[model samples]
Target: MIQNPFARFLTGFVVAAAAAVLPVAAQQAASKPDFHQWAATPPMGWNSWDCYGPTVTEAEVKANADYMARNLKSSGWEYVVVDIRWYVGNDTAHGYNEKDPAWNIDAYGRFVPAPNRFPSAAGGQGFKPLADYLHVRGLKFGIHIMRGVPVVAVQRRLPILGSKATAADIYSKEGQAGWLRDMYTVVAGRPGAQEYYNSLFQLYASWGVDFVKVDDLSSPYHKPEVEMIRRAIDRSGRRIVLSTSPGETPVAEARHVAAHANMWRTVGDFWDSWEQLKEHFEVCNRWAPYIGVGAFPDADMLPLGRLGIRAERGDDRMTRFTRDEQYTLMSLWSIFRSPLMFGGDLPSNDAFTLSLLTNKDVLAVNQRSTHNRQLFREHNLIAWTADDPATGDKFLALFNAQDQELAPASEAAWASSIITRQTPGQSQPVDVDISGATTLYLNVRDGGDDIAWDHADWLRPTLSNGTQTVPLSTLPWKTATAGWGQVTAGKSVSGADLQVGGQRSDDGIGTHSNSMITYALPAGFTRFRATAGLDAAGAAQNTGGTLQFLVFTQNPFRPMPADSVRIPVTLAQLGLRGPCTVRDLWTGQTTSGVAGEFAPYVRRHGARLYRISTARK
Candidate 1:
């Protein structure tokens, strides 16, 4: 049961002594705090939007708490949150909620905790009892709230705590300013405004709230509200993790948000789509450098396994992602260090979905690593690599995002130049070859803001002798946008396994069946590359391979496949060093060469990789 006295504490500005008497250096030093140091710690927790919706109940919250303690505590997942409309709602008997008159009493426009929902939350002490309960069980408690000062505060002329101010004095005289009028705009620097913000934090602090996720703060450039909230939270003397919600914050604003809030969203609500996944993959890689401890760039929720439980406006569809795609999504998110807030109903978790969530290797990448990867997509495939600074292990993931199963002879599209062309008036392509791809590893960061990619063309090829680099200007350009399309190319490999767990029954290593590793082994191989697809003309209905590669072998990195195919390769048909092409990232170039010595073998992760040694053209 949640409990906390509903009270508001207005923030008051403290006037510091004049700094003119101090040394200039001391003044500057005084102004600087080790914000990065404060944020280095990893955040752990579970959100309520998954299992329960707006009508979340105390009994269900307790059950979730019990589950976290028994199964996920050691795994560092804590924080039992009651998400959305907790104050003005009641528990739903079935899967969805019905409005109950007993729960109809509204505390102004602010959705204060409803007594029917939390019987123990006496006297408007919304989440205090639950927070205390979680604390006793070695867990933490959190709740969700919408942005802006509550509308009830304005109507009733509620007195702000810790000051002689009223809510009406704090909110902007202009009232709501955005298309969304759900929250009243509270301008910072307005009389009693800081105090109003401070009072809200004081209430949470008194309630023992460890986390507060505020919605509607990102869309309207609510920097004033955001800044005031930060100051109030800091002044509350309690360490509360602040999370902003609902939309993508611009790259320029990422640093600002990082300085104040613990996390910010990087995209609109993420559902399940191969194209959305691909777009998100590209976006995550682009922002990897900005992420660090404390501040995280949220990629939205993990709508995996199950979805559409709340007022969420999607058909209740089981995820359409293939097993291979699920693996790709998890691996990529883990590598990019995005938050893994599952959106599936917990009690109904299937064996396969549960297994996917609990995979130790996958979780390690998301929570333990310290570095992140940079990715480039060409043709129907994406190339990803992260370097481990500690052990020098290079993690790599290859994805086939095309709609059609690719044939052997089709031409692969190049995505290496996509980044360069994103800038206005930059019509030319880059120069480079994809042949020099290597096994670079990376460290994991909590937020996605610290990661930065200064220049798209700065990537240097990891090439061996005779590796030809192509300039970008030579290849023709094609445009792309959201939805209703397929990218295709020749027969391709999908996914990678950095290290093979062990030998398996099918003579492959992936957990699922049919995944095999492909590679073009070279004598003293320092550099190797392959080309697949970036764009396709028409859609193929699960017919051909969504070309991808996965690595299963550690000592010798190998590419894995979701399914197997018989590509007839006879030494008599083609001399050693066969004809092949690979995309280049640094210059956006694709160079063709003869195929190399080919021996087909399935590695771990049920995938295969083909090593194509290029012959002189």
Candidate 2:
């Protein structure tokens, strides 16, 4: 059962502060001041997770920090973050050390950096020496933490710094992170819960830390703890930027997060894969409107340059994205203005990767653009736009979410061309013109009908070119996306017989509502013939199953975009229909006197970014 996030803060659990140990320095720090002002813009930085994983040493961090301070510092990249597992003395790569985990903490029930890994943290000095190291070099330091008090701290019944209660008094087993077993949730409104958090940040404040990324708090969206952390940071009397992570952070909590964090992740840990990057086009768009003055929607780290040397996910190597795909990643992230956190090892950057990072023109959009949003997505073609308030110009990003070599990565690709609704036991013949079509898409939409129990299938689907006929089942679908379960090639979504109308067949794609199956057309195929209906499993009852069938001559965002059209991006679409000159950001070329449409040429799985300076009409 889902626990109410606010229940821990209930009236009965409320514990009034005894005003014990509120530091004198904290009293003057003005914790309640507008935190949004501390981070007027999204924080740009380098992080250690992608390259070093849990095993990054002090030497490696300083190397990357040195590289950034000398190279990317002038470009507004400042924060140097130490990601997860910093307190584990013997942390390993590819994930956390679950069983027999080694830990390091000070007597005050607060975690300190592992001295074995981060040598400067030795002698109980904590991160002050390292933080000072970066500070002197004109860089800010940040660290990642799991939400709540350390389990070891609770096990020891360590004293809470500002209150009489011990860690054991405030912690409950409720809502713990499933993946890691290092921490326990601090029950809100209980004695010492808030004080323990305040004391934790007070130590960080003493170390001069500028940023803190709290993980496991956002995915399940630990609301009470987030509020507690916010209060704790304020009470610590330091201006620290707060970020939340490991997302698809429920969009339902947008307002709550925007009010609390400097940035919150929109998707799960993004990697150097086309599929992961493609998923962001939709996720970023959905969270764009919630971006506020202090809070930005993060698209996770840029997985470029040398990675996985000792990281959690992959083996050590340069990023796997193509040059075109790399361009698309940067363009989309910039246009959306998601807080730019470079995740790869910086010192190992090759020429192309360096070019991607140091490109001033692109970085400007992320730093300065306003009113950004996805303009529209037609077929596999997508566009996002943002405005430059200072210059009154427009920043446009046109994305081709198609990849010919790889399957389209969209979860549910949508387009409406030919549409029909099927009743519970309805059977229908499908015939569609396939003349000169590069690809054909068969879709089952949840629109205009109930979504539950929407079992569907194509039976004996065939293609003919007036002379030769080919069995549709003879070739596999180029790309398949499902809504409920996996799309079965010659069986039902459940991998059973493709039973439609009480008849079982084995020669077509079986899927559910809100599904799409894409097939690359044969060289001379002119017609597609098939029989479609609700699968016998869902149609058996005939009470709540209703689905819409639609076909498209174009791709519904198949990674292969050979048939995808270059959508005409008209000035009228951007609400600036007059004359303007558009400059291509990547090529440094300008097109003058552009009037109606300003369609920039974008490649498959790539993007085209433009800066449009409108002329007065």
Candidate 3:
């Protein structure tokens, strides 16, 4: 799960605090003045989870913090977050508060920092030293926490805030009464419940904390807790910016989450994958409207460049995304107003990767552009419009996620096309003219879509690892076909083509002996198509008995173009006794009927000629 680092810490703190004694003043401080005005704008910066996972150390965090201030601060990337457990060392035999199997905060769980790890903090201080050090450096500090009161609080028979209450008195025995059970449940509006929250934040506020992320408290499931946590933060009198996590924050609950949090995860964990990135495009579109001046629908962290672990038993090192796909991921996220949180290792960042994260123009969209929602999604393409009110100029992003690659990444490729209305009603054509900015900017490296400026015709291609920025006019779209093939082959690929009314052909499209004839299919598809085709040695490949059929959609979304769905049919199924008919799925009409189309293997690769036509009545 992609968690807000600060919230993850708070989860542990909440668990531990139930057992620790709190002074009476702490309870009063919990209901004090508001704490949000401190974070006038959304917080920015890098976190350690995408790189370190449960084993991150103090030295590494400090290094990342140092790097952010020295390099990324000018780009508006500020917060330096240490994610997950820091209460216990890698060894569990130690006094770590291990809990339910699902949320253990030890190794294989969230790790707590061993006293040996950070000698500066021993007496339940947690990240106070780190937080104070960051403050001295003119930077904000933050940590993560899970939701729900801790089970430990219940075990100790701890004193509840009001009327000398005990833990058993507050916990809801009926699971249905609350959403979470891994942690002790708190009854909202109870005499001591508010005091519990107040006391939690009071300790945090005194610990030099500037940011608090409260997790598992989003959505209708935890509305009451969300409100209580927000109140607690405000009352603590430490203007901390609240962030919520793990997404699924429904539209109806947007107003509530937005009111309390500086940011909330809009989707689940966003890994570095073309498929995941593509999925996020649709999800981000849905949550964009909730993003505003002080609050953002966090798209999660940028798992770019380098990730995983090292040493004895580590994770795989290969990048989850291609250079081009990474560009698309960043561009879409930036244009959508998602908070920019780098999840990769800053200590070992490559030059190319750093460039992508630190690009001035791209960062501007994420940090400065006016928030905007998606305008439309069709033909597998998604487009959005954001107007810079200060300059009265609109910034539009047209994305083509179609799976098409022309050639290898040699140079930046450019495609000039019309952005016309789907339905013919406008007097002016949506011809993108990037002819005006003093310095034309394009994030060529972030690949799913190409960025063009209206005033400046020059579009630069940036490599994903952030390596090179080549002019688009100089690159070839030929390598683009590769991306299409990959997309159709992704995990989400349904059947590429299906032979309706059953029969196969031997005719194939765009297939030479040199190119492999492969097809994508849905999970339960049981049909195909075949056409006449010759083999490598000029020998005919005949459809004898039962050839397989396939079906799938076009891989990448091309910007505002006709959507293509691939269908394959087998000659045996078509029963090609007469003309074999191809039908449309939406209209249920035969597309084409041909006689004596007796063939073996017919594969129409990237079908561009077939139109969505109706059959004769």
Number of the top candidate by TM-score? 2
Which candidate leads the pack in lDDT? 2
Residue by residue across 1-617, what tens digits does model 1's lDDT show?
A: 00011100000001112445656654664554433333343455666674455666787778768877876677666767777767665454212233342343223323456777787786777678888889998988888877777655676777776667677776753535232243477767767788877877777888898888887676434787888888888788777878787656777776677767777777654556554565676678656766666667777667666654542333444565667667667766766777676666555567787676665555665665655655455544554555444443334445555443322211222222221112232212222232333331110111122111111111111224365533222222232112211111111111122111121111111111111123333333343232211211100111111222212112221244444332233332222333554332212344455244222322122212122233333
Q: Which ten residues in a row have the lowest lDDT in candidate 1?
A: 4-13
* lDDT for model 3: 0.49
What's every prediction's RMSD, in angstroms? 19.6, 11.3, 22.9
Quality of model 2 by C-alpha lDDT: 0.79
TM-score of each model, paired residue for residue: 0.59, 0.72, 0.57
Summarize candidate 3's per-residue lDDT along 1-617 as a digit string, tens digits: 21233323333332333333664544544444433345544567877666776456788878888888888788777788766544435522111224432222221111233566556566656568878878777788877765656655565566754346665556664322122233555788776777777766776777777776665555324788788888888777777778887665766777667666778876545555454566676788777655565667888888875676531112435456666566666667777777777887786788877777777655665656663656466645555555454543334454556644323222212222221112122111111222221221121122121110000111112121123333223323222111111211111111112111122222112111111122222132222212211111111111111111111122222344234332222233322233344432112344355444322221111111111111343
What ordering of candidates by lDDT runs from best to worst? 2, 1, 3
> What does the lDDT come to for candidate 1?
0.50
| Residue 122, model 1: Cα distance from true site in angstroms | 2.2
Error of 1 at 562 (Å): 10
Candidate 2 lDDT tens digits, 1-617:
11123312211112212224555544444335567777767789999998988788888889999999989999889999999989888887866787877788888788888888989888888889999999999999999998989999999999998799999999988777656778899999999999999999999999999999998887668899999998999778888999997676788998777777778888656778675577678788788776666677899899999988988665788888889899999999998888888988999998898888888899999888888889998766899988888888888899988644322223222223322334434657778887888888887765343224566788899999888889988887878876555688788875568977667786888887667788887788888888877776555421334666777776444353463347578898887855898998888899888999876567788888889888865
Residue 573 shift from truth in candidate 3, angstroms:
47
